[model samples]
Target: MQTIPAGNYLIVFNENGVREINNLIERNRYSSIFLICDENSHEHCVPAFLSEIETEIKIEIIEIEAGEELKNITTCVDIWSTLAEMGADRKSLIINVGGGVISDIGGFIAATFKRGIDFINVPTTLLAMVDASVGGKNGVDLGHLKNQI
Candidate 1:
């Protein structure tokens, strides 16, 4: 098990890291749990994650379209709306599962919702594992401009 200390959190890299996730959830006792997945992660990674994480806590899944094009304020609004509709409170945790796009957008959603909430990144791609999931950099493009605040 490899663990990298990132700011206040520990990024554990292991085939069985879902156990860590379970432990974190149990330890934190979050009020609600949310899983944000892109279309690709929903189809490819969600099953594996679910199988590995053994938790009685109910989890709500939010699926978004996969692609950089969909990473924007619109998508963030949708995620925030869903979280609100699902009764997510300040103690809710958001698990982002997918590649860079999912992590970036999902992290943004989690960070902005309820003035910020706990979030974990489950990067499912090499690009995300190497870059997006490490730095905690999250943002969306503004129209045709990339990463335009």
Candidate 2:
């Protein structure tokens, strides 16, 4: 029931957050919805996430492999390509549903795609809630280097 305002978005709790998200969707009139999650979240979190969203617009699930090694430019490129192939445009909204890797990479893709589309970070872990989702630092690693893109 708690709501924390973050810029244009409100970081809310549980199923209650979905209501505010629906309000956002109504206000934005996004052409489509992109739910970006890793394998773990897709399996665990996405079912609950999808059930609460009340929208007529098509929702696409973009599931990525779960691992730090997968959080690189190559993966970003693949996802970007997927977004394009799936008809993602400037009016699309990307909802990142997972922890750090998903928040970081998915946010990065949303920020850069079509010169930045709107995105929401639904951090499902303490690390993501305190760090990645709030950090506003998005980019990918170059091998062992962090955030080097």
Candidate 3:
């Protein structure tokens, strides 16, 4: 896979995305792996995602409710607390695997928790895939307004 450098992270392409994800897992030695997904993605995307990843590090699945209605400060706080309770540290890695809601909230959680940890988005839907492929767009809605928080 060809890695296109983007700021502090790298985007893997030109090969099987999942295979590259496996390679990345092999390369990094994280203390723990956190896979954050909505309930839907947890059912549809996670099995394949878990199978492709060959990591011995414990993977904690943090499943959240889907939809924009859930993408708020409440959800962020819940996920933040969950990360703390799940033993996430500075060296821990977060993998967001779901749609736009996952990408937005997941990135926000990863960026804020513990003064920022590493996170990679494995977007499931077409909208999410397009959204995650780009860099540096992360925020949760503030009430009815989008990207407000």
Candidate 4:
């Protein structure tokens, strides 16, 4: 199991990591919590998450179009708009439930919404679980652009 330590933050990892999301949320006293997922994750993970979380906190699910191409400024705009419409605020917490694309875009969206918010990565893919999710490097790649700016 891996532990993500950042300032006052501590996240534990394990096979049943997904099951503990709600408890962790409660412990943190997050004012609001939502799940941001792509089509694939909505189908593959949501049901299991729903079964495990036992809380009265309203759980909002926001599903965006699934694909690497959908990870961009436009996608963030759409998600941010939706969050606004749903009355999400600075105290809100976002749980990203997908692969690298979702984690990156969701992190960016949460980062910008109401200036900033808390985000947890519930990465579903092997690449995300092993690499992208742990590195803390999040941003959409500029199309047709060189790595060096």
Q: Compared with the true structure, what per-residue lDDT tens digits does model 1 show for residues 7-112?
A: 8889898878888999999999999899999878999889988887767888899999989999899988888999999999999999999999888888888888
Q: What tens digits encode model 3's per-residue C-alpha lDDT throughout 36-104?
A: 999999999899889878778878999998888999999999999999998999989999999999998
Maximum-lDDT candidate: 2
Error of 4 at 86 (Å): 0.5
Q: For residue 22, what is the lDDT in candidate 4?
A: 64
Tell me the deviation in Å of residue 100 in model 1: 0.5
TM-scores, each model vs. reference: 0.95, 0.92, 0.93, 0.87
- Lowest summed-lDDT stretch of 10 residues in model 2? 6-15
**Residue-level lDDT for 131 in candidate 2:** 87
Tens digits of per-residue lDDT, candidate 2, 94-121, equal 9999999999999999999999999998
Better of 3 and 4 by lDDT: 3
User: Highest TM-score: which candidate?
Assistant: 1
TM-score, structure 2 vs. true = 0.92
Q: How many residue pairs clash in each candidate?
A: 0, 0, 0, 0
- Cand. 4 TM to true fold: 0.87
